[model samples]
Target: MSIGKEILFFFGALGAFNGFVLSLYFFFLTQKKYLSNYFLGAMLLALSIRITVTVFVYFNNDLPKTYLQIGLSACLLIGPFLYFVLQSGIHSIVKIPLQWKLHIAVWLVIIMLAGFWFPYQNYPILWNNYLVALIFFQWFSYSLLSGFENRMLLQKIISDYANAVPAEKWFGTIFLGNALLFLSYFLGFSRVPFVSCITGAIAFTFILYLIILVLMHRKRTDDLFVFNIKEKKLNQEEAFVLSQKLEKLMLEKSLFKNPNLSLNDTAKELGISTHQLSQFLNNNIGKNFTTFVNEFRINEACEIMLSNEKLTLESIGYDVGFNSKSTFFAAFKKHTGTTPLNYQIQALQT
Candidate 1:
């Protein structure tokens, strides 16, 4: 091997080896089932195996039959493991349904066929090419399915958790990083490529590793779902009663008019946990706590706008519980599609 090729192989092997180690840590050492450790660990392990196989094929010049078989099997798993990662991360679900085993069954059949179907002696090159094509195609197909699944999952997560931090952006980096790795492989492995696949994949691996490092540096255990449902499902009557009680508390007490209002305080007043309140707002009201409170504040500000012509917009904002003029302006514009001053003028003109 050339000096450059040797270095590439060394780093690539190191990265894949590290990835495998991390996967073990995620699977067995980490005790938190809520973070989707098992699925993540499996996915990482599969990716590590594929990387390892690729390294062996590139430097060695000849692919061994057993190695080819194992690599193809691992590649077959990469996509479904990604799907499992999404499932476990967003919902904290560890036990999959028995029917979902259909995906596994399909992968098994593909592996079985690929393992046995080779007419190795007469058309050796053709079999090798066919296996590579099938493996890449399978990986790409599963990637597409995972992309769709991720979109739907993100929507559901946001819709279901009022307190959910904006995680879609961070999670998107995961998909983009994977795409970079795939592009590297495509360029390196395909007939249509000018660049070396090994080099590109290795470069992308460094980039991906940095991202992983950032994700792991979080102080809290990364629970994707911000709120846990004390009870899984709520009936219509129960939802209505809880919602009504919450509304009464907000309306009667004018809770939104407290400048330092917090979700915890409101939950405490209502005799429920903060997670429960978060669930109520998300599921029943279709609003986050901030949005829910701002609605009432904006409505009160409008009433004051119409009824009291003497108050300044800034003062009226403070009266309606905003801590600062900028915050009030932003919330006013968000809710009413106009600044407070503009809304007052527009209201008078009409």
Candidate 2:
């Protein structure tokens, strides 16, 4: 085999293998039965099939009509579903409501069925290209609208997992990588053969997948979601000062404006460690980072709702760093015993 062909085969096999391993890890090790798992599994399955097809095409010098058609169809059909699964998984992890899963699933099934009946020889590249384009459009449109939602949830998960540090940059990198992957696939389907784009998508997907697995694994063991109880029992005054400082930083720096800001992040910004910050909140503030941050965010949200009469509840919620309007309202009620609209009404009356 030529060098280029060898490289392609190696990377293809590597990507397929990594995807398979990660899918299995998620299936067996990860306790959370997230909808993303379904999509991940499907993606791995598709990748495995693609790898097999690539191998066969390389050796036989002839593509099986059924295999090529099915493989292309599956790849195109699976894209949106995979994207949605990733989207929904992030939401589920952060405890957000995402009702679009079923809708996406229904559409996916319809598309897959269309491909099953449609032969590649008859429709050929155009059929596959059109389907791929539609899938990209769906994924992109939903991503544009729901991207912020995912980021918000991602922020919460990172904060809960990383102690209030912004991991959105990492996740943002993953998103950009995925976008490029989609764009690459789109170009390839168009017969443009964007080699760089293809390689980048594969590489980025693999890297991000590994990063997420590591983060999730760490979060499971480290008690990231809870306060350090022993630390709370030890320090009082220092903890109080640290908590106040953390809260001040959160407010003054407009960190609450970031839906994904976490305590570990706060510690980094304040030139301290996550352990110190955790101790501070636990001992002095008597709450975890999530609650503390939510209190400030909800309060800010209330202020925005009262002041900006033209703003929608969701806009106000998003403006103050809450991921969803529901979360904003829930946190508002939890802290002040009033919904955002009610609070705004009362503020106006007063």
Candidate 3:
């Protein structure tokens, strides 16, 4: 090999090796805290193994037939692992259900059938075709599922946590990266024999390393799953009672009239956890904390704008809990579809 080619080979091997090492790190060191992390670790491990073994097969065609068989056998695992990684990452579940074990048992049975059902030589070709077809189908189906999930997760993160830009960007990148990677893999598969894409494998190794690098740097990447999820924080009766109390507090004390009134402060007044209050808002009322508070401020501003002529828009905005005139104008326009001045003029005319 030329010096440049040798260099590429070295780095490719190094990256794939690092992916393997990172898998162990994720599984043992990081995954203990979350089942999502465990599944992600397993997916990375499967990816690393498949990539490494494909490269091994490509570089060493003279190697034993059974080694190829084992390599092909491991490919059976890749799609399922990716599916679980996506599921566990998005579901926020600490424990995956036992139903998945049935899939594993069935996959093992199919793999064993490949080993013993036919003559070793003929079974290799027939069984490999079955495995490849199954792998592609599994990947395609799960890609669709994850695409839908990624969209939902993105909406949830960006909606409830406006400051979660990093999470949003990372998720968008991950989704794009996976899509591009699979497209590359599928296209490359058609051009060459199943495992002979030397250049493709090297490029894929580099890309997978980039993803793993990002995943490692962002430790709480998986927390995007539960970032805005509405946990069942209160039963119907309790939620109703709390919601009533909150409304009473807002109405009687005019709590929303405080420019800096906060969910935590309100929660304290109500003697409930901040979590319960937040859950009540999202699950019961379908509003975020900012939106809910701003609704009250905007409503108060509207009432003042209509009923009293002495107060200027700025004074009215401040009186209704807005910290700044700009915020007041923006919130007024957002809630009422017009600027405060414009709304006042329109209200007078109507």
**Against the true structure, candidate 3 has what lDDT?**
0.69
Span of 10 residues, lowest total lDDT, candidate 2: 221-230
**Quick one: ranking by lDDT, best first?**
1, 3, 2
Q: For each candidate, C-alpha RMSD in Å?
A: 6.3, 11.8, 7.3
Candidate 3 error regions (>4 Å)? 65-68, 118-131, 149-151, 154-162, 165-177, 192-349
* Tens-digit lDDT string for candidate 1 (1-350): 89988888888888788778878877777655544567667777887787887788778866665675675577778777777665655554657767657877888887777667763434458656786677778778867877776775456444534344334434444455565676677666775545775664486468647756765786554433222433354578988888888789888999988988887789899998666777777766777788888888999999999999999999999999999999999999999998888899988898
Q: Which stretches of candidate 1 lie over 4 Å from their true place?
A: 1-7, 33-35, 63-69, 119-131, 152-177, 191-195, 207-216, 219-281, 289-334, 337-345
Native-to-model Cα distance after best TM-score fit, residue 276 in candidate 3, in Å: 11
Error of 1 at 189 (Å): 3.6
Taking the tens digit of each residue's C-alpha lDDT, what string does model 3 give over 1-350? Answer: 68975776676677568768877876887534666557656766766665676667666778766665665566566666666665665555667778877876787898787767653355666645665566666666777777776676556555544333343444555555555556655665657554334554576567667767776687565443333352665778987888889888888999999887877788899997565676688788887777888998898888888899889999999999989999889888999888888889989999
Write down the RMSD of candidate 3 (Cα, Å): 7.3
TM-score of each: 0.64, 0.53, 0.60
- Total backbone collisions for each predicted model: 1, 9, 0
Flag the better candidate by TM-score, 1 or 3: 1
Judged by whole-model lDDT over C-alpha atoms, candidate 1 comes out at: 0.72
Residue-pair clash count for candidate 1? 1
Pairs of colliding residues, candidate 1: 188-197
